[model samples]
Target chain A: MNKNLYIKELKRNRKNFFVWLSIVFGFTLLVLSIFPYMSGMGEGLTALMEQIPPEIGKAMGMDEQTWSSALGFYSTYYGVYIVVLISIYTASTGAGIISKEERDRTSEFLLTRPVSRKTVFWTKIAALFSLTLIFFGLQTVLAGIGLSLVNEGTMDWGIFTRMHASGFILICFFTAIGVLISMFFTPKKNFMGMVVGLTFGTYFLNAIAKSTEATKWIGYISPFNYMEITIDPHHAFNYWGAIVLILVAIILLIVALKSYEKRDMAG
Target chain B: MLAIETINLSKLYGENRGIRNVNLKVERGEVFGFIGPNGAGKSTTIRTLLGLIHPSGGRATILGHDIVSEGVELRKKIGYLPSEVHYYDEMNSRELLEYSIGFYDNINPDEIEHLADFFELDLAKNIADLSFGNKKKCAIIQAVLHRPELLILDEPTSGLDPLMQNRFFDLLEEKHKEGTTIFFSSHILSEIQRMCDRAAVIRDGEISAIENIQDLLKKQMKKVRIVFNPDAINRNLPIGSQNEKWHDQKVNFEYVGPIESLIQWMNESKVVDVVMEEPDLETIFMNYYKR
Candidate 1:
């Protein structure tokens, strides 16, 4: 990878990087703030949550018992929010990292430099992964602080860390998919649309799978289901799921680099 | 080694032919012009040499490096100015230039400063705010700041005013004197005539002729119009008369033969009026295409 291109991309995307970081941090803080009040309501809150349809609750990866535990409460609501936001952030930024040159009409300037197309492609991926790593670190810190402030009893740090780690892997997968999508399409809006469609379409499939045993196999196709607390209640690392996600990411990235190298760029 | 060489280079856009059997050679340190009308494959050939598009057949090289297999290394010693220049709009000119220079490790800062000063460009302005001519100037500076061994410019003077165009040509002459090989492509024939030592004319995806500037000028034809008395209309006229037009008592045509022969033919007829004028490049260019 070329260090110059990586550094230049980091500097070029500084503002967008910070904005994603803020969204991650702010979302974590907002969700963790309500933990104390929910814990105080106790059995009354459990009864009310149970009154809702069991199918819908299952679809959201939540149950009456989840309200009593801090980690479960975090997973049931805040987890989905974090995953969706991260999906949006990583997918859009990753796609923009390469496709922006085409849209902004700077592909000629950048591609004609004394660097190979492979170097440029890898440098951009490195910069994008670095941004995601930063976002994860900041969000983890914010979540830890929020949990400490709202602590009314013992909490599980191990499960929290494991869940966030799994999310990071999923973010990498999303980023790979995003960068691949950018290679096939030239218009920015169309690529962004595909990102959203793929993100939410898989999510709803996972949700529908949760509501019925007959459709449970559909959840296997959605990356979000890999870390859903309702599916893996113990939060143990799903080695098979992780392997599949990683392999797909690697394959997508290889295809993306090859396609970018051969494309006839029109300026 | 030659500065640039292409053998039977062909590129086809699906069924539409881009360029066919295009063979060209430019010696080191020579200024070669590529002239063609719009949609006549001038840009296609240049883009292929730059490795922006893949060719359907044949091969090419610049400075002894194959354009396809060794493009990255080949680009290290070459600079290109596209016909239409665009850059990161958010970057100021200074930042853009700095980022551009970052691709090469040892570019002298002094050269960048010299080019900026020569072009009279304001480096602090955002690229989005610069006018088209100003953007063209910025393109010129970036292309030459590295002092590359070869420069490929495609229609490099589209938006510049007459004065800037002249200064740009002078700057190019200075670079030529310093032994930098230049491949200049333009639709404007006069610019090619003014700046290039030799020129190749392309039409409908083929090179029709490649000639020295002096030889090309010598062969250029003149527009001749003669008005004769109605009774003196000669049925037999001299050969090499073309694009003829006849009115009631006036006749117009292009003359490509010896001037002495034309004068003798005019003396034989009762000539009322005669006018001889140099034809523009388009007329001459169209004539070549017709042949």
Candidate 2:
């Protein structure tokens, strides 16, 4: 395969990349606008916490917050957002990257160029990777905007950096997962569903396993449980399960590549 | 040298049916046309050459390389316009053209512009807004802009109005004059007859016959009709074995071996009126399909 073709695809998909980024950033802005502050939120949250049933508060991660802080905000909102956003973007972009040509009937024109099929596939993957970066970067800006709306005072850049760092890892995790799902599914409408489902499905399993020591191993199954981001190093989120996630992502990408080679494109 | 050659190429789609035992050889720089009905496997054969669909049996070679195996390499030299022309709808023509630039090496942007101008295409219009014929022109511009060695067009003029259709053929003829090899498929008998130096007729997935225009006309049996007076005696009548009433008069009909026999029959039958029908490619193609 040619490397130039891959780069070319990345350049060509600029419009789609921007569209995806806009959707992600727009949602981030919505989330930021809705929740304005943690400083005053703690008292109100505490009052509500008193009335809430124990299980519901625990599920919301509210019971885990000792006091309202940026780190605590990460637990209740930003952290969860991290996993969902990554999962959604990765799965959508991954499945779409390769299958769009087939769905659009553009593969004949695209593949007929000097590029190889493998090159085209990888190029689409690279374009998605770039799109993921732009998406998260926009969200991170939206993250700052989100915070400023909630609190007028300047925030510690350290928290922002840490959160964004976890975001970077999450994006990769999504990409890898997306690639895996894209490889296995056919170019039908259900392909995107399968990819999207995998992300949510794994996250659900892990969330359920987090509460039970007996089924605790199930937490490791979901890629979402691994994305950890916080202010402090010891208590800060690290998403160290990234290693396992990355491994799985690689294996899935390989499966997708092999599947593309073996399967005939649908007429 | 043959630029493309297919030997016993067949494709089966379960019980639905597909092309079978198809053979063709298109020499370099020749404008070869594959003519067939709607479901007669014209597009199927083209798809096989492009490696979009795999052949169940036999093999096709392009520039001396197997299409399935060397498809990646061969694609660079071939430009194709699909029958149902569709493009990325979101981008305007300029943006789409800009995007395709990355896929190819060293294509002159100005040349594309010139072609667009020649074809009177509006580059700023989004594909969704363009009419079907305009969209087809876009597909054609893309296929030819790169100036590929071999252009494979599938019913490239199916949707064009007659004026545009004539213009398209003229453009194709110009492409041929440039020494570019063309292998196009079409269902329009007139267009194929006008454009191709040599054409193949495909029916029911098999090629019933391949012949040049002269030979085709020569091989067809003439239809000679003779109107005889109702009062004419029966002994001097021609060898025509059937009779039909036309304009309240008796007419003898026969598709005889030679023009001389038709003439003899007409001369002896006290013929009041006579007419002879000559065969063209359309009739020959239909007869070939019937067989």
Cα TM-score per model: 0.91, 0.83
> Each candidate's chain B TM-score?
0.84, 0.83
TM-score of chain B of 2: 0.83
Error of 2 at A8 (Å): 7.1
For model 2, what is the error of residue B236's alpha carbon versus the real structure, in angstroms, after optimal superposition? 6.7
Write model 2 residue lDDT over B1-291, tens digit each, in one string: 688999999898886578898899899998887888889888888888888778899999987878888987788778888888667777788777766665677888897788788778899999999999988888888888777789999989866777777777788888899988998788877777777778888887888777675666676766555665777733343454344334445544435366677667666567777776765678778877777
lDDT of 2 by residue, A6-45 (tens): 5655666677677766776766666555454544576877
Tell me the alpha-carbon RMSD of every candidate. 3.5, 4.2
Regions of candidate 2 where Cα sits further than 4 Å from its true position:
A1-37, A41-58, A63-68, A138-167, A179-197, A230-240, B225-277
True contacts kept of 1: 0.62
Error of 2 at B123 (Å): 2.4
* 10 residues in a row with least lDDT, candidate 2 chain A: A58-67
Candidate 2 docks with a DockQ of 0.46
TM-score, candidate 1, is 0.91
- Name the runs in model 1 displaced over 4 angstroms: A228-233, B222-280
Q: Candidate 1's residue-wise lDDT over B140-163, tens digit each?
A: 988887788999999999999998
For model 1, name the residue pairs that clash.
Answer: none
